[model samples]
Target: MAVSSLSLSLVPRTFKDKLNEPRWSESPRASELPLHHAIACSCDRTTGFDEEISGNCKRRPLLLGVVGSLTASLLPASSLLAQEMPANYRAFVDLSDGYSYYYPSDWREFDFRGHDSAFKDRYLQLQNVRVRFIPTDKKDIHDMGPMDEVVSNLVKNIYATPNQIANIFDTQERTVDGRDYYTFEYELRSPNFASCSFATIAVANGRFYTLTVAANERRWRRVRNKLKVVADSFKVLDI
Candidate 1:
C-alpha cells in the first residue's frame, strides 16, 4: 500500500531522450469538463427512478476476456465494500455516470482538461486526483490486450512525457461486481521535478473509465497509502 522508490536506469528507455523537452501538460480541456461534472453537480436533476428502485437494481456483468500473461486477481466485493475510509476522506459519487470514489477531504476540486473530475492539494500544485473516460467498443479490458502491453502503450502515448523519465513499478488487475479493473503504479521524472501516479482503469457501459491519483515524488512516500485508498476506492456503480 506504500509507494516505493524505483531506479530510473532499470526501466526500459522506450521514449526518445529529450532532456530539454518541455514539461507535459496535466490540465484537462474545457470541452471535457461538462460531461463529467454535469452529473455530479446536478443534485436536483432527476433521472426518473425512485430511490428504492435505484437501490434494488443489480450491477451488470462485465464481459471480461482472458487477461494475457498478466497476473489477474479477483477482488472480493465484501472486502472492497467493507474497507473503511479514513476520517479525513470524503466520498464523491456521480450517480449518472455510475461510479464513485473517495478523496482527501481537504483537497479542493478543480477543472482540468479532458478530465471528468479533478482535485488538487490545497498547497501543492502537482498533487492531484482526476478521472476520465473514453468511449470503446470493447466490453472488457482484456480486449485491449495483455496488461503489460496495455500499460506500456498508455505510458508511451497518452501520458505526458516531453522531457520525462517514466518507470512502471507495479500492475494489478482486480474483478469487482463482475467487472475487471486494472491499477497501474508508475513514476515520471523530469529535470525540475518528479511525480508518482496510481491509475485505475475499467471498461463499463461501452466506455473505459480511468481514475488517477498523483503526487510529487518527494511527497509520495508520505502520501502513498492514502493515495492507494483513493485508487482502490474507485467503484463502477450499477446503472
Candidate 2:
C-alpha cells in the first residue's frame, strides 16, 4: 500500500494574495472580523476555481479564534500553524485601562497620550506607521456611525475633500465575549499628508477601541494588518 499525502494545502495567488486574503466587503460593525475572513476566503475560493483542479477549498483563517493559551493547542491542529504575524507586533491588552502584552525581546513601549489628551490625536510612530487609540463606552456609543457617513466625514475632514477615499481594502466585524464592533480600511492619501491612512474602530471591554495610522502608503500597508491582529487577539478577561 502507498502512503497518502494530506488532502489540502492552500496557496494564495498574487503577491497581495500571498501576504493576505483578498479584501472583504466593508463591515459596518467591528464584531464581524471572524465572519469576514470566512466570507472573503469563500469568494476567493470560488473564483478561478476549476473542477479539473484538486485541492481543499479551504477558506477562512488558519487560526480563526485561537489566542492566549488556546493558541498552543491550535498549533498542532490548525492548518495555518506555519503562518506568522508581523515581527514588530506586541499584543495590546486593554483599551481604556491602557494595558499591553510585551514582546519577548522587551521592545520598549511608547507614550501615545500626552498630558490631558482626549483621544483626538495621540499617536506613536512605529516603522512607517502611526498608531493611536481611543476608548468609548455605552454612555458614548457615538463613535460608530454608518459606513458611508463615517467614511464621508473622514475623507472630508482628514483630507480636506470628500472624494479622497477610494477602494475599501478590507472590513470585518469582531467581538470580545459578545460585545459588538467592526473594522474597515480605506485606501487614502492627501496633499497635506505624507502618507495614507488605515483607520479602525472596535467595541471591547464595554468601550470602543479606535486607531488611525498615517504613513507612507507602501510603508503603512501593514497598519490594518497589525490592527486586525490586535483586534482578533482580544479576549475578554475572566470577569
Candidate 3:
C-alpha cells in the first residue's frame, strides 16, 4: 500500500489595524446595540480603548468576525489531528538527547541493545518501536547514499534474517521543521513468521537517527495507520 503524508499549519493572525483603531469621543450605550454586537464591542475596553464610536459599531463585529472566522477555520484541522490521535498513545520526549515522538502509552520501555530507546506492545509480542542513533560525519541523510540504496541496505544488512525475504512496499522523503527524513515501509517473511515495519531515518545534531515501528504481518493491516502515526511522529527536537 502507498504511504500517505500529512501537513498542518498552526499560526494565528493578529489584526493590528482593527485593534489600533482610534476611539470615539462620544461612546454609544451598550443598550443601543444588539446583544451580540454589544458583547463584541466590549473588547475595546479590554484593549485599552475606553471610548466607543457613535455610529454603528457593526464594523467591530465584522472585523472581529473575520479574525474569528479565520482562526476557527485554521484550527479544526490541526485540532482534529490532535484530538483523533490514538488515545492509547502518549508523547515521549528525550530532551537530553534532543528527540521526541509519540508511542503507545501502554507499551513498556525495554532495553534493545544498541538502541537509544525502545517500546513493545503490551498484548502483541511482535509489535515494537525502536529508536537508535549513530554519530554521522556527514551532514544529511542524502550524504549517506540515495534514499533507495540506503533503505535497501538497511533492510538487507540489519533487519533481514538469513532465511527471511524482505519486500519493500513504499518509500517517502519528507521535511519537518527544516530537517529531512526518509521513511520506508516493508515486510519481512520468514519460513514461519512474517512481520511488517515502517522505519524513518533522519540526521540531526550530527547523529543519524532511525525509528522503526513493527508488528506481525497478520496484525499489520489492522494497525498500519496507528503504527504510521508513531513512525511519522519521530522528530529531532530543536536544541
Best by TM-score: 1
The lDDT of model 2 is: 0.34
TM per candidate: 0.65, 0.40, 0.63
Give candidate 2 regions above 4 Å deviation: 1-88, 95-107, 113-143, 158-168, 192-194, 204-207, 220-228, 234-239
lDDT of 1 by residue, 14-128 (tens): 1232221111111122111111112122111121111101122111212233343211221222224335645676656554455667788788776554455577799986788
RMSD of 1: 17.6
Clashes of each: 5, 11, 0
lDDT of 2 by residue, 1-239 (tens): 00011111222234334224221111122232221221112222221101112223333323345355543432331222112323444332222232222121123332222110111112434322222222333322234565555544444444234434345555565554355445555655445443454544443444333444434566665554544444343332211
lDDT string for model 3 (1-239, tens) is 10111111111113453343321110022112111111112112111011111222223322132144444432332232353345567655444355666787678655444454567887775698877665555677777778888888777656676788989999999997688999999998999989899999887776667788989999999999999988988878544
Location of the lowest summed lDDT over 10 successive residues in candidate 1: 1-10
- Higher lDDT: candidate 2 or 3? 3
